[model samples]
Target: MRSFYGVVACLLLLQALLGANARAETDTAAAPPAEVLTLHEAQRRAIEGYPSLKAVGERVLQAGARVRQARSAWLPQVEASWTGSHTDLSDVDVESARRGARSALAASGATAGLPSTSVTGSIIRLRNLAGGAAALGGIPESVDSYRVSLGASYLLFNGFGRKHTTAVAKYGDRETRAARDEATRLLLQAVAQSYHAVQLFRERIRIAEADIAFNARLLKEAKLRNEAGAASLSEVLNFEVRSRAAEAALNNARNDYANARTALSVLMNMEDGTLPENVEVETLGVETEEQMSLPDGEAALQTAMASRPDLMRSQWAVKRAGATVGQRRAALYPSVAAFASRDASQGGNSRFGEDDFSTTVGLNVSYDIFTGGRNRAQIAEAKHAQKEAEYQEDEAALGVVSDVRQAVEDLSTAQKQLVLQRDNARYVEKNRDLVAQEYAAGQTSLALLNQSQRDLVEAEGNLALARVSLLAAWHTLRTATGETVKDWPLD
Candidate 1:
């Protein structure tokens, strides 16, 4: 009985542990849900999270700092320093001569064995005289000394050089800001392309799956016919080969879909490889029918020239170059400045003591009388730079018009292609259905049924591509126009 009870207990414990593990696994599997991302959301996230965008923001900050630095030249500059030193005063000998003179007098004044007391008195008096002479002749040398000095200078005038530099810095900042905007627009366009690619692959994957299912059904029908002696063994083998080929195509489609998703994930800076399976994109064909509100190509070109960030950036570059020319020309005139300084020194016995102080305020004027033609060369370089910027501005305008016209053409072509592809897909689908019915009735050859299904898949894939292409072309047009971020699909 005890053995039976032990067996029952062991079985119950095992079951409980298994149940707990199953529950744990279920919870673990449900912990993380998939993230759904739309096309506009993907672009928005990419723009907000992209490293290149952050780098441009840092550049703008640095430019602002430069502007502040240039303007700070007008503020007073102050500086101070403390210096200390110790000297050895032992080498200053002032008692050697005095001691020698005293020794000579003592030797000359002493009488030979006259009186010990008189000789002693003469030696003591000479020693005292020497000590007094040494004390009076020597000058006390200081062992430690210190000095503290503070100075300040202000730019009363620099022939407007500072003003011109500040202006140049400001213009450069503006140019950088415009460049950042242009970069953002380009990034959005790239995101749109990547997003459409993913959507296109998804549609292709559906087509491939449908093809696989149809091929399987045909293979089964062929095998059934062969078993009943209505079809040849070679026909069954042919259907088997067709089914394998369809599966291979399906695998390729799946790989393409995965690659497309990975590209989008990288663009959005996402680390996790999870993608929502239900995310759908706007159908470009349907959207096109909803509206045709953009201006004509000529009007678009004018808007691009007026509002394009690249063109604005080039204009600012010209302004900055002009300011640089003014700054270089200012070198021809003298600079005037106001300056003031105070110096204090302490030197005494053995320690630092305040002993002297001085203060002075003065106006400074300076000019380079000769520069070996450096100033003229610099001014000429600035002029050339300004001309280059102007030329670039004109080039940018032409490029804008060219881009608008090309985008318009592309959009029109894509729209026409989409319409044709839609009609083709519908016709092929109808043909495929008819052929499938005929094949089931044993009135159509396997080759004809397979070809019809292949045609249908190809037509559908083309239609999907055309739809994405149309959307991409529309995005390109919007990018060329420099529409603000607020005009995007995000709410």
Candidate 2:
């Protein structure tokens, strides 16, 4: 009886443990769902979070600061200064006293031997010596001197150097902004590709699962038929093998889906390097004829030329380089400036009286006399840079045309492929269904039914790929034409 009670207690403990586990699982499942991440939301996150994009944005700010710095040269400069010093004059006083005594003795001796005119001259010399001695004796042992001044200067002329510098800075700023926009456009394209890849792999997984289910159902029927001595053992084994293959395909599709999600997470700069389980990507919508229409190639090229950010940046670079050339050439001319200053200084005391103040004004001019051809070398370098920039601009224009044309052609091909794949998938699926029915009625061979199923699977995968390709091609065209950057809300 005691052993029975112990067994009952063990059963109750196990039941409680199971109930607790069930409750815990229920609590976990009751957690709120995370918000779904749409494609646009993912792009917004990338714009805000991507480190490279942020780095590019910082360059725009740096260029803006440079522009401000260049413009500051147009304004007058003002400055203020204060200076103080202390000096000891005791030794200087002693030397002056010794000189005075020698002068007095000489004056007295000359007066004794000379006539009336000579005596008057000696008296004048002696008086001057006494006054000098008095001034020297009155000198302080230490002296304090202080000065305060305010000055202003304005550039009268600089051979248009300031104008050219400002222009260069402004153009550089615009170029940096355009470069940033281009980076954003490219980032958006990368995000779109990954986003669509996830959807494509998910659809493939569904197709794989369906294939597995069909094979499993057939395998069960084959087993029953074998037991009834109608179907051979080889038939059952064939369905088993096909079922395993379908499972392997399903696993591969799942791995692809995960990889696509990981790629998207990287683009969005997710902290965990993967999206959360609850944050699901939206399913792709049905494609329509209107959505698959091709754009005119010539119009796309024109739009790209007018709107492409990289092309715009290249144009700005050329302008900036030209301005730099002008700025360097300005060194060949003289520079002129106007200046004004007011100063107050005092000695022997800290206070500066009104009488101690002084004022001055002037115009200054300067020209470089010689520089061992340095100025000319600088100008030459700037001219070379300008030429390089022009070449880059031409290269960029050609690249834009090529990119637009390629993108348009890709889009056209994708559109046609999608239509063809859609029809092929429909026919393949119908054939698979008829084959499956014939196999079930024992009117067709298992090999024919297997081939039909395989064909259907291939067709479906191709159709999904075509859809993703079309979407990617459309985005590519938008990026090439700079419409992606225009449509994005950078602010």
lDDT of 2 by residue, 1-491 (tens): 99999999999999999999999999889976776788889988888999999999899999999999999999999999999999776887767766766676556556544564666676776676666566655645677899999999999898899999999999999999989988998899999999989989999999999999999999999999999999999999999999999999999999999999999999999999998887888877798776678878999888899999999999999999999999999999999999999999887676877788799899999999899999999999999999999999999999998999999989989999999999999999999999999988989998999999999999999998998888889889998999988877564
lDDT of each: 0.80, 0.90
In Å, residue 157's CA in model 2 sits off its true spot by 0.8
The runs of at least 3 residues in candidate 1 whose Cα sits more than 4 Å from the true structure, single-residue gaps closed, are: 1-31, 87-142, 272-288, 291-295, 348-356, 484-491
Q: TM per model?
A: 0.80, 0.84
Q: For candidate 1, lDDT tens digit of each residue in 185-244?
A: 778878888888877888888888888788788788878988998889987887788778
lDDT of 1 at 234: 83
Worst 10 residues of 1 by lDDT: 107-116
Candidate 1 residue pairs that clash: none
